[model samples]
Target: MVDFNVRLGLTPTDLELREIQTKRPAEFEALSADDSPELRLVEAQFAGKIVSSRLFRGEKTITVKKDKIVAIAKALRDDQETAYNYLSDLTCVDLLKVNKTEEEPRFEVIYNLYSLATFERLRLKAQVTEDDPTIDTVESVWPNANWNEREVFDMFGITFNNHSDLRRILMPDDWVGNPLRKDYPLGGEEVEFTYNVRGR
Candidate 1:
């Protein structure tokens, strides 16, 4: 057995420092709608189509929309005011609220938007159903969304409408169902381990 000192790479002094340090959520806030370039791009491109807009934690903001996500994205990337040239990362999360189906989907699709020039970040989100999870693809704005959308599609089963090519990126081409749905089961681990691991 490894000693406590050897088990953890951190020294006792390091642990003491960590224990004394008070941790708190980051105090990040986004710019106001009137002052934010992202909002201006939204007004210019989407006009009254935006459903609602709000700022959260002051670091990021969200603009809910009901139509033409692709078009709005294109304008944001091209416009000088909101030159969101970098698609930093794309991912999804499971709310696990069962109502997020045909009846209701407590599930939410969160989009993290960032700009290299402005050094600002925003979140664009849409609600979707589990039965027919569909959202517009941002691939037109960022070609990289081609694979990002596919990852969301493969794991969470959220369909991206108008995606140039929709296929599994991490899973096999003919994967049967979304693996990240929170119900796919942990059945494969033992089977995979027994098949591959040679007993000592």
Candidate 2:
């Protein structure tokens, strides 16, 4: 005998939620750079933290590291053998109304990196704290980062350290707040009309 609410999807199983947590090639150990240095140097850098990473495969992933990002990127590019010369893209993540704890950073900054000499591709990620929400800009090493960082800051409420012009690119300059954070109330934060009112 099941209650109507239970049959109507009001309850979820623990196993179902646990299964959703483990996607392929993405686990806590997998996030560390030390874990996969033999396979990929970049992986070793993010050791034991997959919440900040999205592994696309054995070789590539997207990471969100909000601290010392510029330094880490510079080290990789000038590593002689790993000279990541290509910046494929820079993007932002918008996780609306998620269970984000203030102890952890909430925003993602994604970098698509490539080595011209070896024709290898890797992705880097850095997360920014909600209060400050800032990371060093990589425009010095990759000029393309200039525009990309600006776009992220404009739309996603990120602040790039040492960015030349960190201002709104897509939205008006006087925009009130970043509309992407998980805590942001969706659909204007309240249901305007109720199903009971329709009576259909």
Candidate 3:
């Protein structure tokens, strides 16, 4: 028999595995506001913008209003203290079945940012309603958001306003329905080809 753990370098040293085995689940509670400098910076700068914030398992997520996403993103990237200059990833989540209130939006767009200077990371979320599934683009702040926003548009049917060259990146131009939505029908469908299968 082969020792895959040693081969793959998965062996833990300094009692790492022992610590994980003895850890308590109760230690995963949300951290206080003072514990997160990023949350404090956002709240202090953009008053009334943050809807909610939580720091759990060393990850900080701040939920903000949909309309203010662009402005907030710009500020965070430019701020000397925060300097969240790296746009690590931008994606969306379907919250139709999980929504607790009628007023809650059906979609939530998440922005993962990292600050190279501070060596810290933060996540920002903005809710989007099915009625108007649109929000301002963060491409102005982070140019790489162009493709990330496009992928979200293609998969989740959420529009990023003023995104340069906003179009389907993964799906065909004429493809109907966003595939990543929870409500999107499963299973394959018959696709009508615009071009001949064999060369004429």
Reference-based TM-score, model 2: 0.63
* Of candidates 2 and 1, the better by lDDT: 1
Task: Judging by TM-score, tell me the better candidate of 1 and 2.
Answer: 1
Residue 102 shift from truth in candidate 2, angstroms:
6.0
lDDT per residue for candidate 2 within 65-150, as digits (tens), equals 45657766876787776788889899877543345565656676888888887788777777766678788899998999998998
Range of the 10 consecutive residues with the lowest summed lDDT in candidate 3: 1-10
Candidates sorted by TM-score, descending order? 3, 1, 2
Off by over 4 Å in 2: 1-55, 62-65, 95-102, 182-200
Cα lDDT for residue 13, model 1?
69
What's the alpha carbon RMSD for model 2?
8.9
Q: After TM-score superposition, what is the CA distance of residue 94 in candidate 3 from its true location, in Å? A: 0.6
TM-score of each: 0.66, 0.63, 0.78
lDDT per residue (tens digit) for residues 1-200 in model 1:
22433444556565456456676754545446687777777876677766556666565555455356777777778888778788776777766733333544534566677889988787766666566678888877888878888888888888888889988889888667677776553232222454586663
lDDT of 3 by residue, 1-200 (tens): 24434444554663245545654553345546677767777787788987777777788889888888888898888888889999999999998656268887788899999999998999899988899999999988999999999999999988888888999999999988888886654443444486746674
Give me the candidate number with maximum lDDT: 3
Kindly provide the TM-score of model 1 when superposed on the true structure, using C-alpha atoms: 0.66
